[model samples]
Target: MTEQSAVLARPPLPDDGDLDLLLLIRHFELALLDLFGQGLLAGTTHTCLGQEYVPVSLRPLLGADDFVFSNHRGHGHYLARFEDPAGLLAEIMGREGAVCRGVGGSQHVYRDRYMSTGVQGESLPVATGVALHLKHTSPGALACAFIGDGTWGEGAVYEALNIASLWRLPLLVVVENNGIAQSTPTACQMAGTVAARAEAFGARHHRVGTTDIGVIRDELAPLVSEVRLENRPLVVEFATHRLGPHSKGDDTRPHDAVREAEAHDWYRRYAQSDADRFARADEIQRDRMAAIVREVSARPLSRWEPCG
Candidate 1:
């Protein structure tokens, strides 16, 4: 047995619905990579492979009224919110029936209250402003922004956090800290910690270290409540691992770090704990993703004209 596997306990498989969403995202990302390789896709994509659990876990917690501002690695966040793989795939493929009509491509997508951006620190300020609007207009609704740990270097992030704290906006900042930001490690760039930065702005901060959806939701339930109803800004950072490269085939990490990420990946853990259930769900999603690729690929390139 591998030493890493020996130390890491098996994570319990989530329920049927949760398992389906998780695997759906997992397969969807894998399909994207395949498409990119085949020269069937345009523009670049950042897959949230190992970080799928973050958005899937936060799925049920967020209400339809809540707004989610996503960063570069936002496929999982978009999938969890809408579950429209075909539309998103079409968007990425620049095919007809895309959510943003192909103009947004992979990084930028706008659908009602959910949006994703490729910019590092853009979403935080926008989410903070939306949170302010929700506080007054929607009453109980909140605005959640999903950011990477690398975004901590951005001045706009601190600016938005300050405004969120000062205004007591109903904002939930979800940090997907995968350790590496693009090719650079977080330790190499970031000083102090995310918790400290959030504290500096007086925003409540919580760090999540487990992959269990139940445990994560249970721990954050009341804190989310505080953000939703009490008009407070909260930052929940997940200690996640990015299994895939930053965009395409550009993972420059040392061999050991990649192995460490693989060790903590939930895919093997779920399959190991319940092979029968995991296998069925995995097959279902894999097939679903394959079908989505075929159907979206056949559609004509999306066309959008600017207004005169």
Candidate 2:
């Protein structure tokens, strides 16, 4: 057995009660939609409208020392971890108060211990590198890379997985399989399942369906503990759907009736009574956004520089 695994056995699972967190994420995404519609945000933005549980499920499991690497559609991940919707809005608007100082926009927002990139399949390798560093420096820490189903075909992802598994790096690779990658459906993009690929790489793999927060908490909490304790690579494939388009102005693909119906059912089942909670959260976030808009507007238009 590895020294790290021997020293750190399976830890206790996190408690339930992530419903409030989930609702907060949902409202935050809705606010982003409002901001985008008002043209307050520069460049294209991707919102996790229906797939809030992917990040919300993982939030309680992560430690402050742990690292999170996200892909293009990663605002939910940032908000869930950092809980600073105003900072995110500022960054997306290219204001100086943004996490990246008006440099990295919606796709390239990064803060301490949390990083995201606009390119697909890029975060996996970077996250592996962070895991490698953690193995040597902070053996207790773990790194998580959030990628989409579209990124599965990238050679970089496999390369990172191979290295992580070979080195026994403490990494959790999360694939948010939302069925559609950009405008193209998953059927046209790739073959085989994400779990099979992880198995091929000799990493522990777990698959979960249904976006219910309680179901995800019950299913993922234990798996997250195991991954952190064993100090080994893990791949968790979350079967969810994206209710919104891939990005701004890219809603060409037809919606899946079955997925839509299922998503609605799940939301109603989980978030029905949370209307008051959502309203409260929404009001707070809206007020913060208003402040951000005013602050950004006060700045010279030239300060709204483009992000690379």
Note the Cα lDDT for every prediction shown. Answer: 0.91, 0.75
Q: For each candidate, give its TM-score against the true structure.
A: 0.97, 0.83
What tens digits encode model 2's per-residue C-alpha lDDT throughout 1-308? 33234223322222233555555566666666676788766577888877877887777789998999988888889988987776777677665567777677777977899999888888888898999899889877899999989998899999999999998899998888888888778999989888889999999998876554556678878777777777789898987778776776678865564355344433444334445554565466556656655676565433544648
Provide the clashing-pair count of each candidate structure. 0, 0
Predicted model with the maximum TM-score: 1
lDDT of 2: 0.75
lDDT of 1 at 301: 89
Task: State residue 181's C-alpha deviation in candidate 1, in Å.
Answer: 0.5
What residue runs in model 1 are displaced by over 4 Å at the alpha carbon?
1-7
